[model samples]
Structures are given as C-alpha cells and as structure tokens.
Target: ISSLRDRITTLNSRPALDPIRIGLFGSSGAGKSTVLNTILGKHFFLPVSGMHTCTSCQVHVSVCKSRYYEAKIFLLSHEEWKEEVKNLLMLVESRHKNDETDNDLEHAIKALKAIYGEGAEEKSYEDLMKTVPEVTIPPSRVITLKKTEAQDLASELDPYIRNQDGVVNSSPQREQMQLWPLIKQVQVTLPPSDLVPEGVIFVDIPGTGDANKKRDEMWKESILQCTSIWIVADVERAIGARAHEIMVQEAINACQVGKCSDITFVVTKMDKIEVEEYVRNHQGAMGNITQHTAILETKRDLKIRKTRALKEKMMLRLPSDAEVLQKQDMVFTVSAKEYWNFTVLTREETEIPKLRDHIRKLYLDMKRNQLHDYLQEILGVFSLVQAYHSTQLSQDPPMRQEELQSCLSGKIEALKAVTTLCFSQMDGLLLKGVQSARNTHKRNIEKILM
Candidate 1:
C-alpha cells in the first residue's frame, strides 16, 4: 500500500505541460498583425495603417475549448502606472528645459493623453500628479462573447488593447476612460480549430523599437518565453540594414537564452509588385514568352529569388553560433492581403496555408511528446502496483495484521516528515520573494522622486 501511494504521489507531483508559445516580432507597419490573422484564419487582431501599430501591449491568442470567444485584459498595477507616469513627466520636463527635438516630447504627451485626457501634458507636474489618483484605473477584466457575438469582440477590446489614432478626450457627461494606456497584456481565446490547436499560443508583440522602457522589458520577457520566434518585415525591406541590425543585435541573445531553435523571417506584402515594371526590369530573364505566361513565370521566379536572397542574408548576418538561423527554409515570403482577397495569387501561392501547416506541425509534435510522457508515467505506476501485489502474494503467511500496521505507520511518518520539509522550503522561498519585491519597489519610488 505504501509503495503504491508513493508512486501515485510522484505521478501527481509532476508539473503540468506548458503551452508552446510562438512570439511574433516586427517593426511598425510590417504587417505582423496581418500575418497572425492570416495564420489563425480570423481577423482577431486589428491591422493598423502606415508607420503605426494598433497593438499597444502583448496580445496572446490560443484556442478556447468552450463555445465562447473569451478575452482577459491584464491592467497595470497602481505602482507600475505611477512609475511610468513619473518617467514620462521627467521626459516632458527635460524637453521644456532644453527645447530639444519634439519626437520624445510627442511620444510622452501621447502616452499621457491616453492615460488622462487630451492636453494632459500641458498641466503642471503637481496638477498632473493629483489627477493620477482620480483617474480611476479600470481593473483587469474578462469579456466573453458567444459565437454569434464574435464580431463584436474587437470593439469590446479596442479601448483596452488598440492604440487610438488621434487625441480623444473623455466625455465629461459620461464615464468613459481609455484603458489601453493601463493595459499590461491581453489574452484572447478563440473557438478551437484544426489549424491552431489548444496548446499553441501565438503572442503578437508590439514593435521592438518602442520608446517605453516598460514595453522594452516586456518584449525581452516575451522573447524569453517563446518556443519559436517569427520576425515579420515588408518584402521590399526584408533584407535592409535595419532588419539585419534588429535580428543580429537585439533578438539573437534572448532567443539563445530561451533555447528557442526555430526562427522564421517572414517577408510580407509579396503581391504589391508592379508586374509590368518587374518584367521590364528583368527582360533578359523574361525572354520572348507571352505576356500572360511571362507575368506568371516572373512572379514565381521573383519569389524564389527573394526567398533565397533573404535566407542567405540571414545566414551571413547572423552569428555563426546562432543555431536558430541554421535552418535552410527559415525565410517565407507571403502576401496576407492577396490570400484573403483571393484576387491574383492562388491560396498556395499566397503561402498562408503553408505557414498554418508549419504551426500545426509544431503543435502535433508537442502533443506527441506529452502523450509519450503520460504513457510512461502510467506504465511506471502499473509496474509499482504489480510489484506490490507480487510481494504480498509471496509472503508465507500473508503477514500478520500487526506487522502490516507497523509498516504502514512507518511509511506515514516518513510522508509526514517529507511534507513538512517541502512546506518549510516553500514558505522560505515565498518570504524571500516578498522581501525582494518590496526592496525593488522602494528603490524605484526613490529614484522617480529624486
């Protein structure tokens, strides 16, 4: 009985399987959101316009087991908000003192306006600090919508996740507050699909070059948690110096520490090429083929050439120590708009389906490994039970009742000692964590005030 109990305890104490997270990264206007939407077969993420992004914080999407589309929005704690506001105020003050460039000032003011109201930066520091307490930050919330109400989820989350275009003030007559500035992250759960399985999480990270220090920390943390990283870029600029710098200088180290072996460089907007201009530029390669055939052949050749060139560039620019960049098929040129519109390119040509297959393969591989581990655990337990029964049957007199009781009592005492030790260790760790957090918070407050 004791042996069986030990086996059961061991099995129960095994950690739960963690979901496989794929982090999506890109510069602003790189169509990272569009790529995610294409892969998921749903327009869940709002695609923004040129030089701007709609995702203000990390947006994690996974398959929901239930019938409803659910969203959980995590809000920044009061201390975090206070620290960020103080930093912004200092930047604004520095700008005023030095008459520096307006870029930093503009960003700080925009963030302040998002949190408070329009013209928030014009106020004095004391006045702005007073409003911080009265701003009434919304608590983290979960919003669920039925399948019929799926279309409304975006609008519901807009205030929390989307970065609005212009400075919009809160209405004085109503209780309307823009919550995007306060949101730390958003988790969206969609109905289960074959393409995206339950244990695969797609994290849409904000642009890597964000000015906010808090956001920069989040980007690094998100990269650390990912099993795979996808870097999205415009097809035309996919191999540009900026893209090279970001991948080689900024992202490679985090990916290495995370032990993420899969890194995909996706160049989007492949269908934006002018066919006639391309054909004219490559007339020697086009030969004397008919116009219709020349166009088709030209597109195929261009895609192949671009894909090869991008892959080579990555291999050369990436450090030789980077295992993630070693794969031959790491680069993909896709057109999300063309895939959805189905105008000129075929579904296969668009490459969205191929990307979906890649994700599905990852999910299937993870599930297989988990299932294997579960089976091994079950077999281990079964062996323990069989050995216990065999030992009992081999006893000459089946053991006296007092002897059996004595054995059980000894096992029970051992278990009690083990449990006590575990609890003690856990309590110590918990107390240590609390003290560390308190010290860090105190230091941050002092720095901001000073």
Candidate 2:
C-alpha cells in the first residue's frame, strides 16, 4: 500500500514547464518533423524534402518530469473541427489496415450502427465522434452511451474520415483529406525532452507557401497560440521577404506578450556549408571539443559558426535583386543529412543502413544535438486528464488516477539522469551528488523502550 502511495506521489508531481498545450509551426523543409521525431525518441514522421507532405496536425501526450505516458485531446469546435478529426480517424483506422473499399465500408457501417444504436438518427462519423468524450461512443457492439463521446474519441482517435458511405476515394473527399494533413497539426504526447518540466505539445501548421494568403494567415493565428514558433527556411531556397514577415508579425502581434516570448528560431541546413564567420557576429566558437579552452571555445565557436552558417545559407537564397530585412534570432543551421544523423544514426535499421551512413559521414549530429536539447525540455505532461476523464467508457478505458500519478514520478527520474551525465564531466561531482539508497523500515519497540 505504501509503495502504491509512493508511486502515486511520483506520477502526480508537476513537471517544470507550464501544463498548457503548445504547438510547433514553420514552413516546408523546416525540420519540424525531425525535431518532433527526435524528442519523441521515435522515427515516426516522414522527413522527405522539397515538397510539403504533412497535411493534418498530429497530437501526442508530451510529458516532462512526469512518469506516465501523457494523453492529450485535440478539441475542435463543432463546425470548425471535422476535417482534422477525419484525418486522425483515417490514420488510426489505417493503422489497423482497414481498407476504405466496399468491404471496409461495410465494416464502418457496422461500426457506426453499433455506436449510434438501432433506429438511431442517421449520423455521420463526425457526429458520433463529437460525442466520444461525453461517453456515447459505444464499442463495436453496444455501449452505454453518454454525452462525452467527442472528447473521448479525440483522445484516442483522430478523425480524417472520407465519407458517409466510407468512400475512400471520393475526389472531393480525397482533396479534403489532402487538405487535412495541413490542418492545425497538434502533437499529443510526452515530450522526449527534460528541460521543459511541464512538457510541450507542438501544433505544426501546414507550409505557408502551400496555402493561400488567407489560409496562411489562419496558420499564423494558430501558431501564435504555441509556446514557441520555429520558422523553417530552406538553405537552398528563398528566405522569404518582408511581406512574409508581416504575416508572421500580424499573427504574433495579436498574441499575449508572454505567448510571443515562446517563439524560437531555427535555420535548416548545416551539411551544405563550410564557412562560419560570414554568418556570425562572433568567431569565438571554433576550438577543439576535448580541450578546456578547446572545449569551451569550440562550443562557443560551434554556436556562432552554426548561426553564421544559417545566415549565409539564407542569404545565399535571398534574391540578389530582392532586399529582405534580416531578423535577429538564435538560429541553428541544419540539413536533411544532419537530421538523420541525430535521429536514425542512433538506431540503425537493417534495411536503412545506407541512409544512416550517408548522414553520419556528413557530421550533422552537432546541429541535431542542439535541436534535441530544445525539445527535450518542452515536453508536456497530462496532469489534469484524470480530472477531465474520471468515468470509464471503454473496456481498456483510461488509466486510473493513481496509475497516472505514478507515471509522472517515473519521468522525474530523468532529471537525475541528466545530472549524472553532467557530473561525468566534473569527475566525482556527479557521484557525490547522489542521495543514499535507503528504504524506511520501522523497528518494533514492544518489550523495552530504547
């Protein structure tokens, strides 16, 4: 019983960052997915280049200093939420490999009937999921429905459905699905970082260039709500002009002063350049990683060199005929080559050794490492979820409140891990800082008082 209480204590503790949700937004080839994949400790999103691919926003439970896997719900207004929800449902259903063909359509029809019930009003999938959190989402069979179905479905499933008839390839629906990925993409999960005590959920908007002026403006409005904004400027292409900045400014201007403070800058592509000073305000970061002066100076040099590299990369793309005002923000130069270095290199898959080899040879981990650090800190935790989801609506249902608290405690152990890593640098300092490993055991004093 005591052990259970202790576990609950650990899991319930609040992480360092604010528990509110967050999103990550930028243009194409911006390493947004790469950044997220690194923080999640999994190679989930496609890191393809040149063209924009991510259409719908994805959400996961991001937790820091907390032990349990965080569970997040992507809430969308009644009329405003359909497309994004459909995208999620499609993906979730796809994971089970359920086809959208005739057979699958039959299956979906069955699913719909099971939840909405016999002689129920003809409702669309959107209508059904909207009731998930309120508990009307029945099993594949019958379920004691409730008013909270939408919230429930939003937590476990994302709805990017195709049609009422389960039509997979309705051209109009397909186009809508295509548009789906670019929707307000939200990531709901424990952030794989440690710096953000509370955790962060990055809502990535679709590429601004891919959307119309109005849509792009909408994207910015969404980004303005995030804890930070990371703009992705291609190293080999346009760095955007003052007009683009105006759009970003317009959205940012509307946000609270504190919200604006959450933004950060990232310049993609380090593998393509060699010169450092042309991009930096300083040349101090170029020493060796092993020497004291070398380590300190090299670290500094690396930072300046990388920032300079980003500026140069962006500058290289600015039209010689076009003058774009520069924005001063911390930038880390990176490359697709470097991105894989940070993520895939650590885990060599049997089938993709070649890709890993290519990224490793280019020495791109330097950039990847910093991005990893930034994400490691901003992961969001699910602290108030139990309060929000107390009643069980499914068989496997949500985690018990006690169990959720235990997960939080488990995550807090990472702080000790980070401290230990730093101590390795200070010789015995890391070891000396550890607490004694002792468990309490009460002694009985029955016959004699000591």
Candidate 3:
C-alpha cells in the first residue's frame, strides 16, 4: 500500500520543464552574433569580434519577474584553464615569429598581454603552464547587477561577456580574467521585455571548426540540446563550398542519422551587396535603371539565383537525404545592421520579424507536444493504479487472486497494444515526413541539374 501510494505521489508530481533552446551555429565571423543581436533587438551586448571571439557556449535567457540583469558564468577546471593558456601562448609565440603586418596577430598579442600582463610575451611555455592555478574550484560563478534600461544594461554586460576586449588587468578584474579563459559557459538573464522568452533559451556557440577540443565538445552538446538550429552566414558566403561543408559536417550529417529536426539557413549582411553594381555587371543594360528600380530588380534576381544555388549545393552534398533538407523553408536573407539602422530602404525589408514568428510558433508547438506526452503518461499511470485498487477491494482471497492475475494479464496486453499502436503511428508519421523532404529535395535538384 505504501509503495503504491509512493508511485501515485511520483505520478502526481510535475515533471521538470526544460527550456526550449535555439542554437545559432556557423563558422567564425559568419554574422551569427548579428543574427542573435537582431533577434533580441539588443546591440553590442554579444561580442561581434571578427576572429574566434566566442570561445565557449553562452546561453541567454530572460527573467520576466526580475528587473535586474543577472549573469551566471561557468568557469573551466584548472586543467582546462592550463590547456587554454597553453593554446593562447602558442598562438602568441607563433605570431611573434610570423608576419609583422597582420592586424589579427597584433590583436592576439594585445589580448594576451591584457590578460597576462606585459611579461606575457616573454613567458616560456613551461612558465605559462605553471601560471595556472594550483587548485581547482567549482567550475561556475554568478554575478548579478541591478537591472537598468535595455541600452544601459547592454553596455554594462559588455565587459563580462565580450571576448576581444573583455579581459582587463585591474586588481578586481583578476577573477574575471582568470575565469574568462576557462569559461565553459555563460548564462545571462535579461528583463521580461527582452526578446528572450521566459522559458526559452538562445545559445550562442563558438564555431565547431576551431582547434579547441573542449569547446568543440561544448558546441556538440549545444547542438544536442537545441530544439531549433539556425546556420547563419553572410550573404556573399552563403552557398560557398566551405559553407556547404560546415553545414553538412555540423548539421546535415547529424540529421541524416539522428532524430534531427528542421535546420534554418540565414544569410545575413544583405546590405553589403551593392545592388546597382551587381545589376551593372550582370544585366545587359544598366543605364536609366533607376537606383530604387535596380535595387528591387537586383535583389529579386539575386535571391532567386542564391536559392537555386543553395538547393543545388545542399542536394549534391546530401544526395541520400536531400528531400529532408528541402522540407524546411531553410533560406532566409537578412540585414541585421540595416534593420537596427532603420533606414528607409532597409526598414520593412528585414525578415527578423518573420524568423521571430517562426520561433514563437515552434515554441508553442513544442509545448503542446510536451503536454500531450505528459498527459499520455499520466493516463497510463492512472490506469495501472486503478487496476491495483480494484484488485485490493475484492473480499474472496483465492478467487480474487486468480481474478487479479487475469486482470493483470489483460492490463499488460492492453498496455502492449497501446505501445505498439503508438509506435506504429510514429513510424508512419516519420516515414511520411521523410518522404515529403525527399520529394522536395528531388524537385529542387531536378531544377538545378537540368
């Protein structure tokens, strides 16, 4: 009776609610941060450094009830920090040996100096290894600030979150610097009105193609946790061979074998393309083609061509499961910079709102599905409890035992039937979805191959 009551208590308790996560994944400097900033309508909070800025995965969320900004940073273990220090020192030494004209190399040296002091350049590899902490502490720490206005909050969070200029040498900045190199994760919660929903998380992950193995594992973990994934890129580089390879290697390859859902492709930096120049170069005549007219016509032509090219490239790369790729309205062109600038030409043209809507709907759908599954499990538990109760109420012991055994067998058979039926339905649905994706892929491939 106690065990049965405990089982009932377990069934009645609410299950843990995991937040919906969306992952923005792509190559370094691929305008991924821009896409996220645009989505959140926040500026400069997420560091938009050109080269390997995001070294670890950062998950951003919003707390509707809280008025202040909060950041929970998860630092790496001492061993991990030592490894990161080794990598940074090696890069700095290599830069010192290599070309003196490279600005990136200069930035790397300055960043290293900013963290390790002036002598950082002269430190031997073994000396740098010894510089790491002798003891290991808990891998995470939290920092909270009284909530300020959106713009102000964004500015304040910059030092704590930004990659390029985040590290400083002040006495109080020691902990921040020590943790920055080994930061495995950063969780930031904004105010209620921020673009981040109360129960949904947006993860900003470093590119998987980097040399850091720990961070690469974090990137893979982020992908596994995400409910939706967006592969962001600059419009000029969207369908490039490297872009295709990354998408296939990081996303499509997973979808081919795993329970992968839809993946969206976002082409950012649309404003960078000079429509008039493209029109002049590609079209037969550019004379008398008014700027606005040329811009409209060129954008239309470019979208059409890019879409075709993207489909062809993806199909070629994912020949076996091309259609699954096509099922998603995967291509989105955006100009996050222009959207924030609010210029006449760029104002209503930004598709950030459309993407936002898609995410909102996806979140709702996920909630509904979760609720359905939960209710199904609850019903099963209730039915089992009901059978146990019915058996307990019977007065005739021997007859009741036989009756209970029969009842148990019937219940087991019924449960098996339900399980088989559910599996069959799911299999049918999965097959149908795959077939639809394949059909879409085939149609797009036909258009391109012909």
Candidate 4:
C-alpha cells in the first residue's frame, strides 16, 4: 500500500506542461534575427550589425496573454556576476601573456566595455569587481509596455537586450548601466498573431561558440530543451566548413541527448545573388530564359543543389542512429528581406510562410501527443484504483485474502503489458505513416521543380 501511495504521489507531482520551444541558432552574421522577425510577422528583434551579436543570451519570444507587451529580464546573481567577471579577466590576461589569437580577447573586451564604460579591460580584476555592484544588481528585471506599438516595444527593449552599438541611448542612466551584458536571458511576450501559434515559444539562441563557459553551458541546456531546432546560415555560405562544424559538431552533440525531435537547415538571403554573374556561369542551365525567370530559376536550382549537398554531408558525419537528417523538407532557403520588400521574390518564393506553417504544425502535434499521454496516465490510475476497490468488495475476501492480493498483482502486470503493447503498436503505425508521407512529399516537390 505504501508503494502504491508513492506511485500515486509521483504521478500527482508531475510538472505542468511547458510550451514547445523551437530553438533558432546561427553565427553572428547568419541572419538569425531577421529570420525570427519575419516569422513573427513584425520587426520585433533588432538586427545586429555584421561585426557583433546582439543576442548575448537566449531570447524567448511567445504570444502574450495580456494587452500590454511584457518583458521579463532574468539577471545573474551577484556571486554569478562576480565569477563571470573573473573568467573574462582571466581570458584577457591570458591573451596578453601568451600573445594568442585575439578572438577570445576581443569578445572579452567587448563584454567588459558593454558592462563598464570604454577602456574597461585595462582595469585590474579588483577594480572591476568594485564596479559590479553599480550595474550587476539591477533594481528591477522586468519591463512592460502599456498597449504600445511594435516599434515602441522594440525601442524599450533595445538597451536591455541589444549589444552596445554606436547608437546612443536616450537615457544616460541606461547607457551608464548596460543591462544586456549582465542579463541571463530575456523573455518577451507579444500580442497574439496568426504567425505564432498558441503555446509555442521561439528561442533565438546565440552561437554556441562563446568565450564564456557559463554561456556555452546555457546554450547546450537550451538546445536540449527544444522540440525543434532551426539552424540558420547565409545562403552563400551555408555549405562552408564553419557552418558544417556548428551543425554536425556542436548542435548535434546536444540534440543527441534527446528532447530535440526536428532539425531544419535554413539558408537566408536568397535574394542577394548577382543574377548576371549566376547566368554567365550557368549559361547551359539558364538557356533561353528571361531575366526575371532566370533569377527565380537560379534560386531554385541553388536551393536544390545545396539541399542535396547538405544531406550528403549529414549522412557522412551523422551517426547511423540519427533521425534529424531522415525527415523530409529539412532544408529551407529563405529571403526574409524579399519577403517584406517584395523586390525580387514573391511571398511564397521567400519560403517564410511555409516555415511558419511548419512551426505551427509542430506545436499542434506536440499538444495532441500531450493530451493523449495525459489521458493514458489518467486511465492507468483509474485502473489501479478500480482493481483495489474490486478486490476489497469481494464477498469471499476473508478466506481468499491471499488470492485477492495475487489477483491484484496479476491485474497490475496485465495493465503494464497492455500499455506497453499499445505504445509499441502506435509507434509502428506512426513510423509507417510518416515514411509514406515523406515519399509522397518528395515526389510532389520533384514534380513541381520539373
């Protein structure tokens, strides 16, 4: 009976369901923020300059429940901030002594400057620690906009979430205390939109390669929590060695630990190609086509070739058990700029709508599965209770108490067997259906291309 009570307690203690998190990752100039903005159907996230990353920490964007735009900025504790400063100073000192490559030192210096004004790296560790109390411990971490426009919300969030760009902050106090470098993460809530489904969160994760160990670990933990991951890169450099390294080496390592079910490779800036140069190089491919037709055809052809190449690389690098590369429609070549500007590509040609639909479908599917699992657990508990009550109410219970206990044990084992068999059968049918759908989808895409 105690064992049964423990089991009941465990079931009752199950945590509340969290929204399905879709993590988007890319290097500094990979157009990750642009892709997220396009998906949200607004310019919510500020696009970073080519030189630096604005997303120093994870930014979780979800549909808001209330009228106002809400932002909860989580900050590092005082002790945590102190340790982080120490680590950055160590990196800077190591760079000076060893005369190593400047990448680590540069990032460290930028972080220090963002926290303390310019020329912060020159300060000793003790001096830097003294200044930590002024900014590291914020008065309040949450900021909300009262029924403001998207632009207004973006402006309010710029100082807390964005890196120190040349744009001067209107608030001198905000400039004096750069909140972004000290932020652990930022959660932004926006109004409901057709693009972002209910109970779906889009996390814009910075690149995994960071000089900060704490940030790197946070990235890994975030990757493991994602239900789906979108790996973004510039279309021109999607197949470069660095892109592959991040995709196959860093991101894949975390995904392999489970939680992540889908991985899609997105190549942005498809509209930035030089049509004349492309046509001249692929004259045979662009034979007898108008300039407009040639450009569209070139983009389509590049997407196909790049998709094939990416799949081949994944096959070579990924372990045989990996399921990420097995999914159909895993590659998306999108031009967020063209989607909004409509200069060269149509809305459909940009592929943003398709990506948005994919995200919604993932959320719907996850919710459906959660409902099913919840019902299963409920039914299991009911069976256990019914079994116990039925045994207790037996007329011959006094003489056959031992038999009743044995009977109860048998029912429990039978329940477990039934649940296992049902799950196995369901998994088999789902796999078969998914395989058939993938084949049909692949053929349809080929027909459209032809």
Which ten contiguous residues of candidate 2 have the minimum total lDDT?
137-146
lDDT of each: 0.70, 0.41, 0.64, 0.73
Candidate 1, lDDT over the whole model: 0.70
Point to the candidate with the largest TM-score. 4
TM-scores vs. true structure, each candidate? 0.70, 0.38, 0.67, 0.76
* Poorest lDDT segment (10 consecutive residues) of candidate 1: 167-176
C-alpha RMSD values across all candidates: 18.4, 24.7, 12.7, 13.4
lDDT tens per residue, model 1, 295-335:
35644665576556645555665676565555546667688
The TM-score that candidate 2 achieves is 0.38
Q: How well does candidate 2 score on lDDT at residue 326?
A: 36
lDDT of 3: 0.64
Q: Which residue pairs clash in candidate 3?
A: 68-147, 323-437, 323-438, 324-437
Tell me the spans in candidate 4 whose CA falls farther than 4 Å from its real position: 1-16, 99-101, 109-136, 139-147, 165-177, 208-218, 249-255, 287-292, 302-326, 398-450
* Deviating ranges (above 4 Å) for candidate 1: 1-16, 43-47, 118-129, 132-136, 139-148, 167-177, 209-218, 248-251, 287-328, 368-450
Q: Write the per-residue lDDT of candidate 3 for residues 182-289, one digit (tens) a residue.
A: 456667777776445577677777755554444445666556556667787766676554744555456655555543455677777777666567666765856666
lDDT of 2: 0.41
Question: Lowest-scoring 10 consecutive residues by lDDT in candidate 3?
Answer: 133-142
- Top lDDT model: 4
Displacement of residue 325 (Cα, Å) in model 3 is: 6.5
